[model samples]
Target: MTTTINANSHKSLIRNKVWSRLRAVALPDSRFHHDYSSFIADFEGSSAATDLLQSLPAYQNAHLIFIAPDNCLQELRYRSLTDGKKVIVTTYGIRRGFWILDPEQIHESQWQMASVLDGMENIGRHMTLADISELPTDIALMVTGTGAINLKGLRFGKGHGYFDLEWAMLYSIGKANQRTQTIAVVHECQVLDEELRGEVWDTGCDFVVTNDKVINVKDASKPSCGILWDKLEDGMLEDIEPLKELEAIKKRSRAG
Candidate 1:
């Protein structure tokens, strides 16, 4: 109890510092521009990081990618479609499971609109883990935006663990694997110099791309053990429909 409390306190401090630093360079959603809003900030030229990522060999060769739905990642999601890559993204809050956006499915002019939260729903195909079991095993990238990250490659976001759970479900269902590279896109200010330890459920990234540079991480940790069932936040399994569905699917797979 004591350890958890201290950790939470520390995280609160870091969150405040990160938000302050980031707000200077990025625009928070208009609805959330207030003092306490925790929405990820979207910068005018944040797409520069997306361009940097695309120039990399891994991205160039990748036919599939998984991107988070955070506002900061909106541009990458759009470019992935325009580049003719199949994108896998969780719905906002991941409340609705995974969706796949194929450039072939939508008209070229709508690709940009299709990248946003509502546009994705209107244009992408909703899918379950079972539906994705047939995807090629060579998914090239799993990218997410973070509230704060350090040189140690440790990252956290909104205290929700949405991306962590999304990774766990994908891993458990065999849709994502160790070879699927992961990266974090953040403002340069969100990259901290101090090192921090990662929890067992903390899925760290291999690369940290910022507005200025892409830092290659030496030993970033990833969660291979899948969801820590016992450690999940209260009501996660109860409130999130897809998580419940995934739990059932994984249980039956083990039983069989």
Candidate 2:
């Protein structure tokens, strides 16, 4: 774990340098101006990557998808909704927790608006783990803004660790598993050739789709144990309501 943390720190330094170069030279347009401390890859040229993801057989067959609330993935969510798939997203900061967006549950006029995270309240239904019914082969496609990712399937999110937390929650509830196919859509510039070591908590994606290429990460291992609450920073439980709920569930299960 110490080694993983150190490696992540080293990777982060390199990522910042790469992201700075990209933001300055590769993406200087007004559309890419985001003021967050975490560098979000400019969404200007991510359409091709989204197109490739849409063409995936797994994506086409998935009825339920959990897409992150990200600027680059807005079009993907829109397309998924249009295809009549059930889309679930995290409420901002998981303050109100997660919600489900089904094209059938929302009015046709609001289908486009449903794709927007801020507009979710107007068109989505708040859902709990119990609300979801498991099918034999449910797919999870995560839309992540990465600093860097390697060929070994190791990936680092924009430093927030929200994606990892979400994966843990889903795995704990049995909604996602080791065999459940997972993929990430990133830009070609974000892919790194270095050997990235995976932490016990980090989930490995089965495939990574870039604007210019498709990488198949064979024999990648995802998290098996679910939430590593011990490793979380203090006050995370108080910050995220869903985590509190999950803790209560875990307690009850253990007590019984």
Quick one: best lDDT, which candidate? 1
- Give me candidate 1's TM-score against the actual structure: 0.93
Error of 1 at 198 (Å): 0.6
lDDT of 1 by residue, 1-256 (tens): 7777777777778878888777778775866773424566776557888777877777778888889988889989988888999999988777788899989888899899889988988988998887888876556789999888888778867888888898888888777787778888888888888655567888888888887888888777878989888888898888776789878977898999
Whole-model alpha-carbon lDDT for candidate 1: 0.82
- Cα deviation of 139 in candidate 1 (Å)? 2.4
lDDT to native, each model: 0.82, 0.73
Candidate 2 total steric clashes: 0
- Candidate 1 lDDT for residue 255: 100
Worst 10 residues of 2 by lDDT: 23-32
Which sections of candidate 2 miss by over 4 Å?
A: 1-5, 24-36, 39-42, 133-142
